[model samples]
Target: MSTDGKSPLPPMDWPDFQPGWVWLTGAGPGDPGLLTLHGLNALRQADVIVYDALVDERLLGWARTGALIEYAGKRGGKPSPKQRDISLRLVELARSGKRVLRLKGGDPFVFGRGGEEALSLVEAGVPFRIIPGVTAGVGGLAYAGIPVTHRDVNQSVTFLTGHDQNGLAPDRIDWDAIGRGSPVIVMYMAMKHLDQIAAKLIASGRNAAEPVAIVCNASLPDQQVLETTLSRAAADVAASGLTPPALVVVGGVVPLRQALDWRDGLADASVLDAIGRRTRDAG
Candidate 1:
């Protein structure tokens, strides 16, 4: 077994990356190790790879020699291609007899827009395969010692995006219901409107003092976790200068970090505060 990042696999009965077909694969959060075997296989065989903004570029090194690389990533508040254009590009590449690979961060279908691209492939009659990867909501939280669901803390979890295409809080989501019903909530792309979203939840009856943890650059070497209350989440994030590409989780589970955090560094100051509060409460 190779101890290094390269994966020139010892041959197996792997499916062929046929010309005129696209494989939509997930690269996982930010850790290259989180990549699935099937995703790695697709990489070594694809003639061309179209990747997203969040995808770790290091994964590209595993691609076949001379394989073409194309960037199709979209970041909020930046000039980016239209989703339609990206989908069409996949079709164009596949139809041109290239072994196409559409790579994304996290699970392709889990809010990664893999479904929309798949539909485009379908409409174009291009064959494709899906290789699922660990989503940041689950895997990212795990690295930060926050469980999305636990028998002792929560039976239901809600995963949501903080903003819609217009870059504002989503109006269609019944925030009131989610605030009350979901014992654990994981939010993607939420840092931008953290304060507004927190207020909405509080207004919807969620406790202002509920524990909330923001995991930044999750699963990466520079990963940082900030633990605070719903009321303090926005303020703490601002004061700490935490940025996007982060996951926000709200629940009683957030306090469990005291016992669960196993990373090399000490837990954040806010996390220590949470532990003291919990200890006092238990006493």
Candidate 2:
């Protein structure tokens, strides 16, 4: 394994993380191994690391000694720092001549509200850099042995959040259009509203028996995957006793988990060969 647990790659001169600049970075799901080199570079250089709840604590180990680590994670129904306050804190820290690193789980741009924070920094005249990380929608699903797309399943996929700014199912989302157009739908933080979302899709013409997979604590050692039908998803998830910080995937691609699950020792050699053949054929 590479020193960081990620795949080995050619070395290059990394960018200088200037003090008094804010770096918004994605920590990549829950696995330290999945973190981008650029994100890792920030960790080693930042004076203060402001991290979210979903970010694995293990990644913080890479930070420089004496680097101040601050918690600013926001969870459903949890009393946490307000978004605006968090943005202001970045501005405050940057102005203090500190190298501020805003480390979040998954891609900072994907449903992470990084853009909002960046805008605040811009208005405050704070220089910043964006380091994209592997989103849970893809990386997390991969860890659960579920592909977002497959030649035999879907050619397109949709990524969406389960709730809006108000912490409820988004009212702006066109369930009808998405249900009818997208063959595969990957949802972040949808476990809380799974029943309603599932109903909306079913009412919008999605099959009631469509395969759905919910992955919790994705990319972590204790990751849990629960598979059920669109109609029974809510019930099954409740029965499984899993909580939030989970991803919900809706599509025909979910059943492929039976063949693609490779984590630990769960991989089946025959299925692996079949997947290889299919991939080669597609290529």
Candidate 3:
């Protein structure tokens, strides 16, 4: 129980909520404004926040003064705290009755490993809540002025991880099925193996000239988007030195991006304007 009179007040003959423990939270993709109310509440109340590398640090400023922050980011082939260790630490902090917040980039359940951590907490009999966030596959695409689902393009969309933590294409994912099945495919963390991935999709009967859009550092000032055909995607990324923490979208929806893009006139503003005028004239 906390020393404060307002906190840790017990219910008559019932168990109390643990104060020192964790909330495994997703901060959303790059945009601080996208944080859920529950997530923001946890951040403000937490005694410590263990966060991923991709999480924008600026969001940490929202935490109450004197809160502790820990970095537990795991990047492919980069030195990082082991997942097991991170999970165990959450348990440890909770046992101590300290409010712990495990902050991750994007939805923690979407390839962010919130499940593993949640299971660990469950095993320890710790109560927890899931605060979902706007995942990169959707939000990142939106930031780049691309819509994952479009009435004219696709009614269905598929979200997939590019590679696993080991830097290999996830063995469990059926690339062939995904290539053949999904009308619109959005991938996260696939830049490193983009060449081989592109080849696989093509071999699975996807068109070589199918449009592919790669948006790196989505929703941030350093963001860049590259438009290419499936066959040229890997080569173009390589040539341009684009790196991961990027989102890739494939299929016809990539074409609409050229028209939907509204910022800095990257898309033809004149064209959309002309189309609007024509619609008005027709009406």
Candidate 4:
């Protein structure tokens, strides 16, 4: 409220969502609240919202009534719109004088095809802005009550994708190096190849019994976690029947979830089928 009886909704520094342009925004993980202020603002004014599979549908409620909501999510092993086609659609929408907001899950640059889309926009000369959202590794671990880095455990953590563009576990990365040095490893889009990845880690220098936590639909009501060891992770995940859009965390930090789990194992049913030892103290 103001003296003029007007609401100070958006600050003066807020950038207007101009037509004939596009905004590449990260929608964060599965929680609607993880959406950035800029992302919400773009949603309110966007004539077309191109959202992804991991993006919570609840966030779309912020969009102005009658706005066009389009799905362009790329889930592994599922039929998805071609990446090239999706990028061209944004250009087409902007050229047609529509305010386009290309919404993605997690930080657009981190494993999201945002760079490819941004390049497409640049080649086509479409003006655009980038609004970074909370990446899954950060927010997901927070929800699971696992610290990304623990002083007692190790100061270094590694973040990587399980599969490459071709949907195969990345071979170029030196898993041996990561397993030998990295104290904590957070992986995204890894459910499909969890077994192969775990084998690589074991073959590299990581202990077979190293604690591993698989988080499914993190930061959302239906979040499920499987706390197991690196050796049993694949079998436990298979037996538990957890699905994709999940994260696999391997390190001593996995045990921290027992104390930090605020989900309380109640209505949200945050199931934790632990196949490893659990203790209240991190030490």
lDDT of each: 0.88, 0.90, 0.82, 0.86
Clashing pairs in 4: none
Candidate 2 wrongly placed segments (more than 4 Å): 1-11, 269-283
Candidate 2 on 151-189: residue-level lDDT in tens?
876899999999989989999999999999998999998
lDDT leader = 2
Cα deviation of 258 in candidate 1 (Å)?
Answer: 1.4
> Once model 2 is optimally superposed onto the true structure by TM-score, how far is the C-alpha of residue 23 displaced, in angstroms?
0.5
The regions of model 1 sitting more than 4 angstroms off are 1-12, 265-283
Worst 10 residues of 4 by lDDT: 274-283
lDDT (Cα) of model 1: 0.88
lDDT of 4 by residue, 101-218 (tens): 9999988998898999999999999999999989999898788888888676668999999999899989889999999989899999898999999999999978888889999999
Candidate 2 vs 3: which has more lDDT: 2
lDDT per residue, candidate 1, 1-283, as tens digits?
2224564567777777889889999999989989998888888888999999988999998888889999999999999999999999999999899999999999999989999999999998999999999999999898888778867677789999999978898889998999878888899999999999999999988888888999999988889999899999999999999888999998888887876777755455566666656633422
lDDT score of residue 128 within candidate 1: 94
Report how far off residue 278 is in candidate 1 (Å): 3.0
> Lowest summed lDDT over 10 consecutive residues: which window, candidate 1?
274-283
Per-residue lDDT for 113 in model 2? 94
For model 3, what is the alpha-carbon lDDT of residue 276?
Answer: 44
lDDT of 4: 0.86
RMSD of 1: 3.5
Deviation in Å, model 3, residue 111 alpha carbon: 0.8
Error of 2 at 203 (Å): 0.6
**Clash-forming residue pairs, model 2:** none
Task: Look at candidate 4 and tell me the lDDT of residue 113.
Answer: 86
